[model samples]
Target: MVTEQHSFITSAKRVIDIEAKVISALASRLGQDFVDACTMLKNCKGKVVVSGMGKSGHVGNKIAATFASTGTPAFFMHPGEANHGDLGMLSKGDVMLAISNSGETAELVNLLPVVKRLNVPVIAMTNSKHSALGQHADVVLDISVEKEACSLGLAPTSSTTATLVMGDALAVALLDERGFTSDDFALSHPGGSLGRKLLLKVSDIMLTGDDLPLVKHDALVADALLEISHKGLGMTGIVDELGVLVGIFTDGDLRRILDARVDLHTALVQDVMTVGGKTTQPEQLAVEALNVMEAHKISALMVTDEARKPVGAFNMHMLLRAGVL
Candidate 1:
């Protein structure tokens, strides 16, 4: 007499154990066809057209996206749509990869004649080697599983998991074969943090020109404080008359002056400026600028060009706004 909760937990554990064994068995069955499939995809002169029905269609879409981002050109087409004008998407020299656990999905079989007339090579992912789609493919990737996790053995569970892992294995194999780099991946994901690290430049977010809060080196300390207030970055840059950065003045220095009884009204900016403050390049990434500020225990840095002129300024606040932080 197990409680309902106990029965639920036991059933879940049994499913987990069964699925784990299925995946482990699948891993050991990888063979030459895996390599051959990767090679075919990498060398395909045209797109890799992936098609399937039901749950297999969902996995096909993800596998196509992975292939496209990693250097292979691919797209997922619905077999159900092929009869409705989408079959025109197929072309000669293209490779068609079809996914069906039983390899007998009616909609997939319905598209085979059109795919053949278009002269596209077929790669089939299926559990049955004698299934219609399997017999027609140039390469057959066997994603067979002994049994599903379903107690009734009617639902798709272990079989779908094996297909997903096998698809990922194919994608990674092609990625390595094509020498796909992180830069390539970042290009496809420019809005993500990885894109900020790779594509964003200091110039993209730094303050520049009239926006710079700067005071002359010989300016009185009161004038430097005024510049800081005008800039709103809680700091001001001190530059030589030549517009070359000489030092930086911050709220920290203003506090130190008050503590020392120094007269802000009469003191020259040069007397309190921190010389050679941390700086970044206009071409450097905003993400790198953030790292430098965090490491140096400062919130601001001057952005310089190749000539060491103070071209721009930035602080941690700006980085957060730009999503670099």
Candidate 2:
């Protein structure tokens, strides 16, 4: 058992070391060709069509997704499928990103003449620039590695990693050049937590109108407590005669008043409340509101308008329920 475990650890470490070296060497190989590829992709009016065979096809799928999500329109096309009428997906004004570690993939090479005839520029990822795929490409990105991380020296391990990294470099370069923002990325990924964080606003989750926990500044601490309890927001907003928010009264304040032996019946809620408490606008992002709550160590906040009037209110529980926590 010990011998098997030791052998497993040794093999894992060796693979990691070799792959890490291969990735590190990629930086030194990036030059004018990388820049030209980025320029071609950025200038392309149509979508980026990525094609490969076998294992390279799998990597191409992910690379295409990264490109699509980062503001660069792209999609993967299996070379085998393309040969069977799917080649219609490629069109004028589009760019071809062909991945083939060997640079001699028969399925991919056969499509070169068709791709070229359509006037589409080809950017090739290969181990040798002198190979057939490279010779046909407008720009050749060398993804060469000394050897595979596979002990048999035949599997596509380090070479695939290099190809994936190169794809990432191209995608990110185009993303940066186009000035893609988080808002753009969020639009592409609208079904997950990331989308909610970027797309949800305080107005979308805040308790408005009748749900707002609000009381007159002249109200007694006892009255404020009643409002807090009725609203179940753990806090109540204290507003002045003009209906402008002036302070906040929370459970924490009640505990402090109890300790001070203040008369809840007669003490004005404004006197004991936190003056000018933390506030957020309806237009603010929920994540930004959460940041304010966390930074101030508070659990609730009053959403105010331009006139400083309490228009809405919410607490940590509301944020959690809205998936903003």
Candidate 3:
């Protein structure tokens, strides 16, 4: 007479252990068929169309997105919807991957006749090679397991885990075959911080034109400091009359100049400035700016053109605002 709560907890741990072993065993079953599946996808001229029913459909959708973001170009289609007109999403050049733990999902099976008429390649992902979907597919990837994690063996825990692992194995194999790079992945996920770090360019984040804190070298130190304060970037670029950078004046230089008792009003901006100031090019990646800031231990950096003319300025705060830090 075990309590229901105690029984549930025991069953839950057993569920986890069963799925863990199922995933471990799947690694040993990979062979030439896996290589053949990778080949079909790499040579595909059209998109990879993934289909599934119920729980397997949910995992298939995630797998498709992973494939697309990694340069494999894929999308998930619900087989139940295929009968309702979503089958138009497939093309002769496209490869369709159908997922079903039992390989007997009626919705998936109903679409197979039309899929065959279109002459598209079908890769069936199923636990039973003799199941309907597996029997009809051009290539069958066996995902069979001895039992489900559920004590009643009715829930899909272990089977779904194996299906997800198989999908990831396929997606990663294709990604490697295509030499998909991190920067390529970043382009598809621009809203995330990792994407910003990899894809964001300096020009996209840099202040430019009138936003630049620029002052002539002959101006009084007080006037240049005013520009720095107005721009709110803690530093100002000291330029010659031709608008070329001659030097820079930061809060640090201002402190040293004050220590020497230099008259703020009388001193020329050039005399108190830090010459040949550290700068970044507008074409550089924003992440590179982070490295430069770290290396120099500086709070703000001025963006310059190839000719060293000031174009923009920013500090660590901008990185936070951009979600790139």
Candidate 4:
């Protein structure tokens, strides 16, 4: 049984090594052709239509998604479907990114004439520039592999990896050239954690108005504790007579006061509260607020305006519920 496990591990390592080498070698081949592909994608006025067959199609779908999410408008059109009625999906001003390891996929090759008729420039990802697909393409990207990772040399393994990498190369190149920002990426993925981190503002998730946990600086520590419990934010802000935030009191402060045997009913919150505790602005990103909290080893923060008035309050639990954590 140990020998069988060893053989399985060896085979997996061999496959990984071969594919890694294929990817590494692809870097040396990048030159003007890669730049040209990026130029085509960058200058494209319409969506980039990616098409391929079988495993290549699967890779094409992912490549198209990467392109779209990275600010390059793109989508996958199955070659077989294009041969039917979906050819209309390709229109003027669109660029075709055709994928085929052999450069001679019959289904893909059959769509070239119509593609040319529509004046759509084709960028072929294939093993050879001499093959039909490559010959017809305006630009040929070499996605050739030295050998298949598959033991039988029949499955599309290394070549598919090369194609996917090349596609990523094009997408990322265009993304950089277009100056795509994280904010732009967040717009395309609002439902995702990255989007929440990038786009969500402290104002969006913070407790405001009556929900804000606040107390007069003159209030007793016991009253501050009641406000903290009522607001359920694990903390409360202490404001001066002018309604400006002066300090903060949290559950941690309560524990410390209890340890010190302080009189909660008699001690003013300002006297026991942390003076001028860490605060955030309403316009600040929630992720930035999270960084401040993490840095201070605190789980709650008071949001103040320019004049230092407490306008909002939030805790780690609020950030977690809002997916900012």
Candidate 5:
């Protein structure tokens, strides 16, 4: 059992090493062909149609998704399905990215003629440059691996990893060319945590109006404590006579006052408040607010307007609940 466990570990390490080497060697191969491919994809007036067979087909689906999320319009069309009516999905302005490790997958090769007839340019990701798909393609991206991780050298292992990495390289190159921003990415992934972080403004989930835990500067510490408890935000905003934000008092401040043994009944709220505590704008991204809170080691922040008047506020719990944390 010990020997078998050792053999399993050794095989796993070898597989990882082979895949790693395949990815490492990809950088040096980024030359004129890669640049031309990116330029072609960038200049394409229509969407990208990614097609592949078997394992390559699975990888192509993800590549298409990455392209779509990162500002490029793309979708996966199975090569086998394309000949049966899915071919209607392609148009003259579109570009096709066909993936085949050997570059001669029959189902994919059969669809090349229709792809070319439609005037759609083909970008081939394959090892055999002379293969049917490669020969018909407008651009050939070499995704050849030195060897498979399989001892029999039959299964698609390192080759598939190389193809996937090459697909990522193309997608990212196109992404950079288009100057795709995080906000743009968030728009495509509205259901994910990243979308919440990017698209959700501080104002969207902040406590505003009557929900704000607020007290006048002249208010006693006891008054502030009552406001904090009633609001349940663990803090209260302090405003001056003009109703402008002046300071903030938090549960942490109460702890310090407790240590100092200050008379809560007689202590002025302004005297115990943290003057000029961290503040955020209503329009700022919630993620930005999170960064500020984490940086200052504070739990809550006052949302202020241009004139420094308190408009709204939020705490770490609010951010977490809103999926911005």
Candidate 6:
């Protein structure tokens, strides 16, 4: 059993080593072919149609998804289905990215003529530029690997790793050219955690109206502490007579007051409160709010408006509940 466990670990390490070597070698081969591929995708007016077979198809699907999320319009098409009528999805303005480790997947090769007829340019990712698919391509990206990671040399491990890396390279290059921002990525992934973190606004998750923990600056420190307990946000916002946010009093403030033996019952909230405490706007992203809290070493914040009025309040717990953490 011990010998078998050691053999399994060694085989896993060998696989990682071979795949890493193939990915590293791909960097040296990247040059004009990569630049041209990115240029073609950037200038394409229509969607990028990615097509492949078998394991190549799986990688192609992920590549298409990455492109779509990063501001490139792209989708994967099954080669076998293209001949039966799915080729209609290809148009004059679209660009076809065909992937095949051997560069000779018959299903993809047979559809090239019609793709060419449609005036659609082809970008082929394959091991052999001499293959039929490569011969028909306008840009041929070499995804060849020195050897397969499989012990039998039959699996598509190293080759697929190379292809996936090259696909990612193309997607990110296009992403930079288009100036894709985090907001754009969040728009595409609205249902994911990243989307929530980037898209959720402070106002969207803040306590407003009667829920806001606010006390007049002239109020007693004991009154502020009562407000904090009632709001359950570990803090309360201090507002002036004109209803502008003036300061903040928190649990930490209470601890210091107790240590100093200040009369909480008679001390003015404003006198003990932290003036001009860190604040954020309603339009700011929740992640930005989290940054403010972390930077100040505070657990809560007073959400203010453009005029410096406290319209809402939020704490770290709110961010966690909203999945912005």
Query: How well does candidate 3 match the true structure in TM-score terms?
Result: 0.87
Model 6: pairs clashing at backbone N, Cα or C within 3 Å: none
Stretch of 10 with least lDDT, candidate 6: 288-297
Tens digit of per-residue lDDT, candidate 1, span 162-198: 8888888888888887788887888988888887777
lDDT of 4 by residue, 43-97 (tens): 8999999999999999999999999999999999999988899999999999999
Q: What's the TM-score of every candidate structure?
A: 0.90, 0.98, 0.87, 0.98, 0.97, 0.96
lDDT per residue as tens, model 6, 111-198: 9989988999999999999999999999999999999999999988999999899999999999888889999999999999999998
Query: lDDT tens digits, residues 1-325, model 2?
Result: 9999999999999999999999999989999999999999999999999999989999999999999999999999999989999999999999999999999999999999999999999999999999999999999999999999999999999999999999999999888899999989999988878888898999999999998999998998999999999999999999999999999999999999999999999999989999999999999999999999999999999999999999998899988988878
Give the range where candidate 1 is weakest over 10 consecutive residues by summed lDDT.
301-310
The worst-scoring run of ten residues by lDDT in candidate 4 lies at 32-41
Worst 10 residues of 3 by lDDT: 201-210
Q: State candidate 4's TM-score.
A: 0.98
Q: Residue 26 CA error for candidate 5 (Å)?
A: 2.8
Would you list the clashing residue pairs of candidate 4? none
Flag regions of model 3 displaced more than 4 Å.
1-15, 191-195, 240-243, 256-262
The global Cα lDDT (0 to 1) of model 3 is 0.89
Query: Where does candidate 5 stray beyond 4 Å?
Result: none
The C-alpha local distance difference test score for the whole of candidate 2 amounts to 0.95
* Per-residue lDDT over 74-154 for candidate 3, one digit per residue giving the tens place of the 0 to 100 score: 999999889999999999899999999889999999999999999999999898889999889988888888789877888
